[model samples]
Target: MPASIHAAASGSPTRADGRASFQKARRRASVQALLLALPLIVFLLSTFIAPIALLLARSVENKEVPASMPALSRALDAWDGRGVPDEYIFALLATGLRDAQQSGQLGTVARRLNFAQPEFRSLLMRTARSVRDETPPAWKPALIELDERWNAPETWRLLKRAAASPTPDYLLAAVDAQVTPQGNVAFVADNASIYRQAFLRTIAISASVTLLCLVLGYPVAWLLANLPATSSNRLMLFVIVPFWTSLLVRTTAWYVLLQPGGVINGVLMGLGLASHPLPLIFNRTGVLIGMTHVLLPYMILAIFSVMKGVSPVYVRAAQSLGAHPFTAFVRIYIPQTLPGVGAGCFLVFVLALGYYITPALLGGAGDEMISQLIALQTNTQLNWGLAGALSAYLVIFTAIFYFLFNRIVGIDRLRFG
Candidate 1:
């Protein structure tokens, strides 16, 4: 071989070896990075992601009837839902009810059924009590004799729906709609409807609070951005101090201050601004006040962070070129501060949507928000399925707002101090 060809072949192998070593090093670095992130990924999966997944599953879960009365549930699978099931299915239901009652699982089935139709729980309980000991010779007539509702095709359809392993009933009810006996989606009666109104009320209150925070925090943020560093740092303490206090404490403090005989009403009365104490507590005003106070700091900090980075020269140049100071500030400074405003508004609004403590304590029945209803379903009603459905909707709303914010303002540009 020629000396030059041998030299080139040797150099090519050396270059190939160096490239392989570089690739190996890069793979090692990537593995190390992944290993470092493993704990955080596992923690998130277990705590946040898993719980959300479970909640979504729970929303559609219809295990109560199937788990408690398996035979009846199995029979229900064969039901066409056109009319009541045949005598054989009725016989199975009787046996299933007897077994469920003996096992103390009848209540679970009844409760699940009652979510589909309000009178179902009472009907099931009455029938179970009647048939607890006796095996009816003819279950079809015996059940109908026990309760006229048993003869209704609608009743059987509702039962079939509740017996299914996974159902949309809870999810539909969460939005103030339901599946009819005819298997059609329809809104509930006006008087019976609540969730849709509650959702709208929640959105309205959150938007109101976001607007209030922006109005109150903007000037403060501008001041912080413009002041000397020492002065600004001192002023920032006012915004940060509230965060150090527990959220509940701040809400409770507002609860005390906004009452009929509270400091705010007292002051107004003493100043002769009002002849009597105003109804501040247990109203929408109190909810707005409490939420705005809690969220104002977030708005201020977000705006201030962006403002701190903004040069003063733009507004100054506009003013120096014969633009009015107010005009220059609005036209130049405000436009630059919008990313922060968007961040602050999105943060405050999303937070306010899930607010329970402030609204529950401060607002009246008319001012009730969706969070209160979720708490009601979980704590008061013991209806996990309904609560999960409500939570699913809230998550969806948050996600929708997040996408809208990202589209309009670019979430990547957001600043939070």
Candidate 2:
């Protein structure tokens, strides 16, 4: 065979070994990459995905008592509305309470029922006490006398209603409901429909703040984006200076500045600007001022970041083409900055929707956001189910906003800008 042909057919032994070794190294690198991603995958699954899933579950978790006490649910399933419940129904309640106590979820079961009928907690406690204190033979009669109508089919019906689970029953009530037995629908009582209103009000206030930020930040960002690097750096220090202080400090500073006797009023008085102190703090005006100050930087940063990428040549070119300054900016310059506008709007809007501290400090009764109500439910009422449900709804609202924002303006546009 020719030397070249022989070399091609046999290959070099060292070259073959080198190729095999390279394949092994590549396989090892692939395994290393997979290993490195494993922790992050696990962390996201556990901390982010898992908790959100559980929270969503809690928002609709209604079946615990009924599932545990199937026999009671079945026994009560047939009865008419006239008579007292029988021994089987008592057995179901006893079983449900025992299982609830065992699972350490009696509290959860109790609270759901509490929303339907506030006396449910006391009923659960009494039933638990009755089960512990009285002998088995006396259980039915004693419980009947404790509430003689307890034997009535309506009483058992209420228990079954509380026992229904994995349903939107909680969501129904979260929005305010008088849920009916025959249908899944609820009638929203005119007086009790606060949640829907609160949700709307929250969205409105958030949008207002976002608009204020846009109106106020646009000029500032435009100026900053046009300045010399040193001037821009010095100007940004004013924005960043607030970050160095605690959020509470910034909020409190607004309180002092806006208060009747504070610096702002003093200055106005000195300047003969007003005869009386302005009602600035502890109201809607105060909330607007404080939130606009707090969230303005986000707007500025978003706008400035996008503005930096926009070439001045575009405006110059437009002018060179016989466009006036305003026309060039509006027709050419402004379109280029829409991505930034969308980003800053999304950021400020989302932040403002969940705003708790600034609103709580500055807003009066009418201006309280949903976050404040969630806090009240969790802390004051100790109603975790309601709080959890509210949180779930808030997350849903935020997700809806994010989805719409992404649809209206792609996330890529925001990120690249």
Candidate 3:
């Protein structure tokens, strides 16, 4: 009592000073922890984040045409797109083309433009070749005389648009949309569209694979959970052994089985189930089978893990309470299995979205997915812009799907059963 009264009289707060010291200590510890992690953070940024960021930025940055024809790109900036360009615009183009042609880069400009409007490459190549030796007195008339396409205001407008830096043309084209001559977004004609169809096929195939994994894996998971440990372990070895095998090897095995003269067909034919071998490989059926087989283990494992934890007592109690066996199983057991179901579906769907080798090796021309299309652009056509755009689109789709799935199923609670 005397110490309390004396402390109150002195009015020196002990807790405040201790708190200040504690906070200072905490700050020092935090700094030390950050310093320890700094190298890992820098490494990730340099190796992973930096490259991904650069690729994503390339999807929207367009410099090919503008870089080749700087003078024309600058001059056309002022020319109204309403009618045929003024002499100044033509003069700029004539000189720019001559300079670019001499530098052997005019073809590059033309190639970039041709992606926006067909036949532009030939138009530009012919014009540049004809005028390479002559300095025309009147550039506008010379250009128009060389090619009637030069007279169209739409052509000039398109040229101007194409040379504008950081264009949307490539990004738009990735999704089957185009920047029209009138400066508007329009979908490419149905026949010319490839991205939209590829995206649809990817989604359809992924959804089908997810559904197949769920339908096929759930029963196996339940059986494993109910079986003796020894038997369950042996069965699980079968499920997991596929993972130990090479993906290429597994796909090839499926190919052999699904092929016309392959094992499955041979058996069916010998059993008189069909008159001839079925058309399975090199089609959607082959794509589905390969994807499902590769991904089914993940579903089984996820469900089996969760089911292992669920108590049989709950089902017994519900049955003892006068519920039928099916009702008890459905009401008491299934509700507890939801987390496993969500986890399995989420994993299977996400994996299926990125599947490449199986589809490429097993499926036919029409079964090509977005990843293959991106690869075709990146490798075959060497169109990095389109490839980057498609990648960005896929990333966006995956992120959106993830967000929606998380919202609906509470991914945080989706324990890996």
Q: Pick the candidate with the highest lDDT.
A: 1
Please identify model 1 stretches exceeding 4 Å from their true place. 1-19, 411-417
What's each prediction's TM-score?
0.93, 0.83, 0.89
Q: List the residue pairs that clash in candidate 3.
A: 305-417, 306-417
* lDDT by residue (tens digit), candidate 1, 146-260: 8999999988888888889788888998999988767799997877779998999999999999999999999999999999999999999999999999999999999999999
Question: C-alpha displacement of 213 in model 3, angstroms?
Answer: 0.6
Residue pairs with backbone atoms closer than 3 Å in model 2 (clashes): 62-165, 62-166, 63-165, 84-151, 85-151
Poorly placed runs, candidate 2 (over 4 Å) = 1-52, 63-85, 94-111, 124-142, 151-154, 411-417
lDDT score for candidate 3 against the true structure: 0.86
Top candidate (TM-score):
1
- Answer with 2 or 3, whichever has the higher lDDT: 3
Residue 107 displacement (Å), model 2 = 6.2
Worst 10 residues of 3 by lDDT: 408-417
TM-score for candidate 1:
0.93
